[model samples]
Target chain A: MFRIAIEMLLYDKTKYIGLLIGVAFTAFLVTFAMGYFAGFMTRGFALVSENPSAKVWVMDPSVSSAEATINMSDSALDIVRGVKGVNYAAPMYLGNMTARYANGDFQTFQAIGVDDATLSGAPKPANLLRIPESAIVDSGGTEGKLQTPIYKKDMWSYDGSHLNAPTRKLRYGDTMLINSKRVVVAGVSHTIPRFPPRPLLYTTASNFKRLVPGEKRYITFIMVRPTKNITPNKLAKRIAKQTGLKAITSDEFKKETVLWYMINSEDVGDMVNMVILAMLVGFGVTGVMLYMFTYENIKQYAVLKAMGASTKQLSDMIFTQVFISAIIGSGIGVGIAAILAHMVSSATFPFRMMWFAPLIGFLGVIIVSMTAAFISLRPIKKMEPGIVFKL
Target chain B: MSKIISTCRDIVKNFNSGEAEVKALQGITLDVYENELLMLVGPSGCGKTTFVSVLSGLLSFDSGVCKLMGEDISTMSDERLTAFRGKNIGFVFQAFNLLPSLSAIENVALPLTVEKRKRVETLTLSKEMLEAVGLDGKENVKPSGLSGGEQQRVAIARALVHNPKFIICDEPTSSLDHKSGQIVMELLTEIIKEKGASMIVVTHDNRIYKYADRIVHMEDGRIVKVAS
Candidate 1:
């Protein structure tokens, strides 16, 4: 019976190719859309995902997501480092700052400052750094010469007193004014998985304090690493109790990132809607094509019925044909989607394929193809054996 | 006389088109006995197909009862009638109604498979039936690959594979050439005798009348004559 169904599906390759293409395109659209959505969400929380040293992040109790918090204190770090599980704890700062170029162009940039002794959340260094005044700028972030000055000759400045620009050219050993104080660029770093947005600059916590000008005791957030026996969640609870603040693990932070995107990000919802709509269109096209195929073969179905085939036999055969189409089409579709994702990633598009999305898409195609078959079953089930004998 | 495998008494079938009702079969009484080859000869619009459909439990009569193996077909629900038909009857049609997707042997094995017979056993039996119909090496060939005569032989093999108590052939050879038609008629006759199963063949072609153990002629939905 399965053989027969497969043969029937293959019998009209030209006709079914159209249906297969419809299903394939639908699968590709669904998978690609989902991949883009996931990529976008990851970008929204790249800071947390890329953090390597922080086993637990202490944040404001009311903060639902990583980006929603305003609470930061050195008091929380002192207490967390004193816990039994804590091996080392350091302050981490995150805030939005405006960077003005020599052309007077301003862009909002996320500023991250970590202790020079323990750079837990800092960007991975591609070049050597030996000075505390020296900073690393993401080379991909700004358009400037390797060692030439692009900005004004004067030292750069920020609105807050915590940050200081040491140099105008932003090269090694060049001084720019950051918050009335001067700092230097030590080295440059390249891209990493889930890197922060372009035009990002990294500097030391001492330089950051010059721009903000608060009690040097306060930090934006705390980073902690557990000892062998200390679990992140347990340490987080201990810290929360001691400092009256919230401590969240990296996994918990990731979840909070996803939650934040789901609540605040409109692109995620739009992508989901688009995927669903594409699937519906795929089902509709396949259904119409399959219906026409069945309609063309109506006489054949009647003939089989006249030959003593039960209704169940006919239904199973048609369903099998639909199943075959979906399997083949989805396989081809996912293959194309994977290739496209890889190729497009090198370009400007932020496309990342989560292995699970294609699997879900494959299952989605099966369900949609079955739905197409179900729509065509009405004509098959109604086929009268008497029609075969009619003159 | 052999046992009466199927009997229909005063069966009436009517079709309703909006408010108008057309009578297709009226007051038709028939008895099909085992081991008998009954041929129903009639003109177009004479309700031959309708009578056979009703007898096969494929359609219901407006009035009167149909009994197959002494079970009331008319009173049985569609589901029960279907089950009963699958077990007790085989059918061959004018168009050589073989499932084109299935190979010759697979087509012949359809009934056994529908009966939920074991796969290996059904295939073995189907191969034997195909060999009996002189399609020995062609079992794996699909219907489209075979000639008209070969396809009809496969159809005959399918009908007889289950060894049902009764067989129904409606214009079984109408689409075949004269020689192929004669061959099919001979094969039907031989199988009917070998299995002791009753067969009712409805056809306008009178060339194969000698193959019938009994011939029933019909006109205007009533039996005009029964010749033995």
Candidate 2:
């Protein structure tokens, strides 16, 4: 009987293909949309992820996310260091500044300041280009437009504001201007691109204060490491208690950053709407196609009923058809999504195919198939066996 | 005398078509005996098809007593009635009603499969039944590939494959040519006699009336005459 059900569904190649297409489209769209959402949220806490050595972060009480932080008093660093479980605390400065290329091209950049002695929050060298231990280096220019140009003694500025054509990519020993002061490009660093992409510039705290020229008490956050045998969460609690600031573990901070973006950003709402639209299309297409398929074969069902097939047997056959469609269609859809995810994925545009993406796609397709099966069953349940004789 | 296999008494069925009530069957009373081919001949709207539907438990009579082999079918639940039908009765439809997706052998094996019989045994039985119906070398041919007479033969083979005690046929030969109709009727009556099963064939075609052991004529939902 199960075999017979499969035969009946497979006999109509048109409807069978239609059903598969409907399910596959749903799965693909849902998976890609959700994957994009996951990737975007991950970038929301890019700062926390970059500085894994920082077990805890102590920030101003008003700070909601990494990108939304307010400057804290420079003295807060010493207070955090005084906590019992704290091993080390470093004052970090985060600000946006403009850098002028040798061609006289100026571009805004995200400037990060680490401790001059330790360079505590700097990107790990294992994941980046190796630099000399003695060189005073700054890193940026991972993007195409931000790449620096080699200097030419005889060449003057093409536009006097932006370079018309860059002769060569920037390398070590190239010089750029920051705040009208010459700054040499010592090393290039690779990092995950920030949301609303901006090139990053890393420098020591003293250099940042000198380059930007600001008032006193300019520390944005204090990155702290817990002492041996003390957990990050425990240290964070102690720091918050001592400094009367918002202190949280790195993971907790990341979550808070993502949550703030989810609540405040319109982009999240747009992504959610795409997911809902995909679901509706899935349900509508599958339900209507299944119903149409069943309607076309109603006479066959009547013949089966009149020939003494019990309702349970017939129902099982219909469900069997639906189950097969759901599995095959979902597999095809997820496979397509994975391929597309591989193609369009980049550091700037976040698209992560998390393990849950396929599971969610499969579950969603199953639900659509089941709803379609129920819709198709309505007519069969109401059919009279005697109608076989009439038809 | 042939053993009585089924009895129908005072069966009345009315159907509602919007605001009007149409009487499909009026006080139909008949007996079907074992190893006999009974023909119910009537024009359209004369209730022969409705009577067989009630007798075969495919329909509910507004008021009647319908019993198959001593069990009252009208009192049976849908599940029980369907089970009983699968175990004891077979059907042949006007259009052959063969599933186009399935080959002749699979069509013939349907009743046994519906009962969830062993696959090997069901196929063997179905093949033999097809052979008996003179469809020996065409077991794997689907209905679309078969001629009308060949398709009807497959339907007859399906009806007899499960060894049911009763068979109900509605306009079994109405769609075939005269010669094909004659061939189908000969094949059907011969198989029923060999299997010792009773059959009720409802049709208005008079060309094959000679195959009947008994004939009941109906008019306006009532039995008009009985001929033998």
**DockQ values, each candidate:** 0.32, 0.65
Native contacts retained, all candidates in order? 0.32, 0.67
Tens digit per residue, CA lDDT, model 2, A257-318: 88888788787777778778877877687667767877788888877877778888989998
Tens-digit lDDT string for candidate 2 (B64-165): 899999999988999899999988999998988899999999999999998899999999999999999899999999899999989989999998899999
Superposed by TM-score, candidate 1 places the C-alpha of residue B140 at a distance from the truth, in angstroms, of 3.3
What is the lDDT for A111 in model 1? Answer: 59
What lDDT does the true structure give each of the candidates?
A: 0.75, 0.82
**For all the candidates, what are their Cα RMSDs to the real structure?**
5.2, 3.9
TM-score of chain A of 1: 0.84
State each candidate's clash count.
24, 0
Top TM-score model: 2
TM-score of each: 0.83, 0.87
User: Best candidate per DockQ, number?
Assistant: 2
lDDT of 1 at A248: 85
Model 2 chain A weakest lDDT span, ten residues long: A126-135
